[model samples]
Target chain A: MQTLSFQFSAGQPAQGRALVGCVGSGDLEVMLEPGTSGTLAIEVVTSVNGSDARWQQLFQRMFSEQQMPALNISIHDFGATPGVVRLRLEQAMEALADD
Target chain B: MNDRLDQTRQQHYQAHDLLWGFAPEHLPLNAPAWVVEALQVEPPVVVRRAQGTAGTIAVGVRGKTRDQRFACWMPRSAVSHSVQPEQLIEPGLAQAHRDWPLFKALALLAEPLDQSGLRWGVTGSLGFQLASGIEVIHPASDLDLLLRTPQPISREQAKAWLELIAQAPARVDVQLQCPAGAVALAEWATSRSQVLLKTQVEPLLVDDPWAVEHVAP
Candidate 1:
């Protein structure tokens, strides 16, 4: 297993914490909590090693296009495909909005 | 099909069929070393639901480890023998494996499955062992099953099926092969929003897997 962290500039902290997806089902599980007012942080625990660059690129590609609230995100990844990772992140963010 | 003259019509090979006589030479030139070495044993490849070229069928070669699977296409003509998952579990075909937790789960599922009358079949390690007698199943092996669903079943029906499957001694995973793709039976039963539909090319989280058109990404 490998753990990687990333930080991004962000808007105000999200109003509430939220969790989405399930780790045991071969999908990425994501948990989001309000973070420092101006920073977004993500910690990923992945079963696949040597995927640091992919995660970096994925997060950069995602965050560059849209602005998001400052939140601490914890991801438990079970070798999920990039699509699954993206979907779970979106799902977690949406769950936070629904909270 | 009786009046059909199209010779190139693709032959139907469902997911989980064990196909024999696939030549290693047909594999891509840059195939992984492990894939080439695994084929040296001449194991029957398992048919996958992925789409392939007109004359080829998508198949996966299994190696020793969980990460050793390699997907490739094999010409239809290269398939000399085919055994469907249901065929492997025919009453007299399987050697007695009752002591195995996997088999115990299958035994527990038999009566309800038969009574339900859904077109279901075995798959995964247990099916592999039964088909080839390779004994790949371990003590902790989960019983994997495929439920063929040309017509979408109600969520209530899927929930019922899940409850029945949950009674097994071991964990069970059931995939519902809808007309378009496959979805986990558990997700279809339980998910409040969209469920993940596994198509040949990609997985799409869709509200209805049985829909006619998918917004392919």
Candidate 2:
């Protein structure tokens, strides 16, 4: 298991908690919960080992591009492809936005 | 009266029967150990299938407090009544099965289990999407299945099932249901000792389902 943690600046606080995706082959599970601080904290647990740098780069790019709110996101990945990971992250943010 | 009894006998329960009995709080202290244990996780609503005895039905109990799911058996006599899974499945999954190729393929693969007296249902993100009408399934999402079987399966049988399921176009996670409870077939086949099983109350690291009883602390 590979664990990576990062924090990013966000605009506002999210109201509710939402969970998206499942940790399966070529997929991952993302859980978005309201955070205490004003920043977005992301922690990822992936089956793909030795990809910490790639994960960090992907998350940093996503945070910089998306106007996300203050939330705590936890991802459990089961060898998800980059495209699938991006999609799940977007869906998790969308779910938080809907709330 | 004989005809009425015959009609009732001929009416076998199908997959995804939602059975309701006395609430957990209302069950007597002396109720069957399994029933009491199962009620502690989910409510009395049991998802029925054709996997148990004639008078008993299989139910899938999912824990709201934890990431656990259990396959249990309950006596039909105790259940006040039951309903179909269609009533529980939201419209999203039905619509997706028609429009999405992956879900459509999953439906096709699952279609044969019922005929073999083994019932199958989705339980992971796809199941959540079906229940909540949410778009939780991604292009690479796996098809996690909760399989109900009439009896305990041997390691060889479990391995055969897994090999068969792995042939699907997408990744497939199959949880084999036994008389006592359910455990991932992969774990059951591979683990030499202490296989982790999702029981009605909590997750237990036991040698086998037969050893899973009163696991809660």
List RMSD in Å for every model shown.
Answer: 4.0, 16.3
Candidate with best lDDT: 1
Clashes of 1: 0
CA shift of B168, model 1, Å: 2.1
| CA lDDT scores, all candidates in order | 0.78, 0.61
TM-score of 1: 0.80
TM-score of each: 0.80, 0.42
Tell me how each candidate scores on DockQ against the true complex.
0.29, 0.04
In model 1, state the lDDT of residue A79.
Answer: 61
Clashes of each: 0, 0
Error in Å for residue B118 of model 1: 1.1
Candidate 2 regions exceeding 4 Å error are A5-44, A47-99, B1-93, B97-101, B214-217
